[model samples]
Target: MQTVRVELGERSYDIVIDTGILSGIGERIKGFNFSKVAVISNPTVFNIYGDVVINSIKNAGFETLNVIIPDGEEYKNFNQTYQILTELLKNKLDRKSCLIALGGGVIGDITGFVASIYMRGIDFIQVPTTLLSQVDSSVGGKTGVNHELGKNMIGTFYQPRLVWIDIDTLKTLPKREILCGIAEIIKYGVIWDEELFEFLMHHRESILNLDPLPLTHIIRRSCEIKAEVVSKDEREAGLRAILNYGHTIGHAIETETGYSRFLHGEAIAIGMNREAWLSEIMGFLNRKDALKIKAVIDSYGLPSELPEDLNADKLISHMKLDKKVEAGEMKFILPEKIGKVKIQKGIDIENVRKALN
Candidate 1:
């Protein structure tokens, strides 16, 4: 087992990583104040590991409430959040009772949001099953639901009490879902660690093969990078914005597709490619490096282009409403090099449209 710490002073928590760690979760939660625990997951994920999670809490002598929502990005909304909160009320759970987010990003995001708002505030634990959630969504303390107008437009910065990552859960993920996760892992390399980028390039085959050693290294390194970033800028006030390198246009794609067509990482893979192109055009990145970026993204078997029939103008319109917009301008986390990015603001909208085209 390995641990990464998100150093937020009073809110700091450990991200524990290992295989089959889920079985030991009861021991991990032993001292928390909550007697009754709520496990929030989607029907699909709940069907897979529901019994084990419930049994773990039960063995620890805590009452467990199962809250299962239909699994999908479209379900991450105010209505679903209301449903979880209603369950808490129906069971008469107090603020001391913590919420356990036990699935992928959608489950983690909304579950955390529900915990943040229910009865003012309640602690939440993140047991992210998917690679996307384990590396990105589960660590940052950024929790929210998507709005039709834009993705993650409605949200809050609330940290989880603890994050328990059991890589064993990934065995059940589909190939497509694993690709989605690889996209985010690539993002960490692109924005921060040059060595990580090189490591990914060298181990591309190992990653595709899902060998245990490389997989463990990737997760631990990604978590370490994310933990370091969030520790410095917990609220995304400045430095942390770089983490959104591909997210500006990525969220737009998810909204345009009604959160159905592409997974979050799929949209992000496309966004990162487009933004790299834009950066090259703006002279921040050279064409050689830009193409290399796209090449790596393509090698992951993820999409790097806007859909053939999707309208560029429509995408720009959606981007205008993104949460990253500041003072009427869309801000982009543009890469200047493989291991560095800049939070570029005041970009011309026409340029974004051109990149989309």
Candidate 2:
């Protein structure tokens, strides 16, 4: 077992990673003095590893209940959040009770949001089952549901008490889901770690085949990079904005497509590619390096270009409403080179148009 710590003083927590770690979670988290615990998951996930997690928690002597929400990005909204909140209330859960986010990014996001707002605030644990959640969403403590107008437009900076990652859960994911995760993993390499990028480029087959050694290495490295960044800029005040490198255009794609079209990582993958082109056009990144970024994305079987049908005008319109915008000027996190990026503000609309086209 390996652990990565997110240092936020009192809010600091450890992310525990390993295969078959799920069975030990209750024992690991039992030290907390919570009065009650609620496990939040979707039907699809609950059907898989639900019993193991619940049994582990129960064996640890904590009173717990399972709250299953509907699956899918479209269900992550006020309606589902309200449902979870209502369940917590119905069960008489107090402030000391905890919430366990027990599925992928959507489950983790909603559970954390519910914990943040439930009776003002409550503790929450992230047991992210999917690769995307395990490496990125589950570690960052950025939680919330999507709004129709924009993705992640409504959310909180609430951190989880612990991030419990069981790589074993990844075996159950579909091929598309695995690709979604690789997209985020690639983002970490592009924006922060050159060695990681090279590792990914060299070991594409091993990683894609889900070979345990390389898979665990990338997940650990991605979490480590994310943990370091989040610790420095917990509220995305500065350095943390770099984490949104692909998200500006990505979120716009998600919002414009109504969140039903591309998964978060898929949209972000496209965003990263387009933004790389924009970076080259603006003279920050050379065409060679920009194409190199695309190559890594392509090698992983993730989308590197926007769908031809997605309107450039509408994508821009949605981007205008993104949370990253400052003073009506759209801010973009553009790659200066692999392993580094910069926050470019007030970019010319024509430049964005050229990249989109």
Candidate 3:
């Protein structure tokens, strides 16, 4: 097994990655003091892995309850959060009880948000079952539901006690899901590790085939990079903001499309490409490097441009609602080059308009 430690002082935890290790999760989390555990998941995921996880937790001597919520980005809202919160209350889960996020990013976000608000705060574990969640959302403590106007506008920096990633879960995912995960992995490369970017460019076939060697390497590297950033900033107060590399415009697309048209990482892939173009136009990145970014993204079969039907005006309007906005001025994490990015604030709306168009 490979491990990445998220060093958050008192709240620090380990992210465990391996193949076919799902059966051992019980012994791994047995050290926590909680007597009761709630596994929160969507129907699709629970149907596949719920019994194994719950049985493992039960064997470890905890009272376990499974709650299944609807699966989709649109279901991540006040309604589902309230429903989970009510279920926890009805089942009498208290401060000493832990919540387990047992699905993908949406499940992880909602479960973490519920744990944060439940009894003023409770321990939560992330058993992310999707590639997108395993490499990205499962590592960071950012948790929240979406609002009609914005993505992740309603969330908290609540940390998890553990992130158990089992690579076998990838086998069940669709090719598009794997591509989505690659988008975030590519984000890590572009924002922090040039070597990682080159690795992806060189080993595309092996990574796409889910070859254990390269697949494990990219996942571990992505987790390590995220762990380092989160440990330093912990709350997006400074250095952590760079992790939002493509998220500024990505979240806007999700909001404008009502979160149904594209998966989160799919939207991010498009955002990264468009933002790379913006970087070039604004003089931060050279055309050759910008094209390189686009080239890699394109090679993955991910979308690299806004749909012609999307209104540029509406997309810009949604961006204004992003959390990065300070005093109503928009900020962007623009790539200066691969392996580095800077937070650019007070950029003219006209420049953003040109990029969107």
Q: Candidate 2 local accuracy as lDDT?
A: 0.91
**Model 3 agreement with the true structure over 1-357: per-residue lDDT tens digits:** 999999988899999999988878888888887868999999899999999999999999889999999988889999999999999999999999999999999999999999999999999999998888999998879999988765678999899999999998889889999999999999999999999999999999999999988999999999999999999998878898888888888988988887789987889998998898888889999888889888899998988889999998998998887778899999888999999998999898888888888
- For model 1, the stretches where C-alpha displacement exceeds 4 angstroms are none
Best by lDDT: 2
**Model 2 error, position 20 (Å):** 0.4
lDDT of 2 at 133: 91
Local distance difference test values of all predictions, in order: 0.90, 0.91, 0.91
Writing each residue's lDDT as its tens digit, candidate 1 over 167-213 gives 88999999899998899988998999878877887888988777878
- List runs of model 2 lying over 4 Å from the truth: none
> How do all models score by TM-score?
0.95, 0.96, 0.96
For model 1, the run of ten residues with the poorest summed lDDT: 146-155
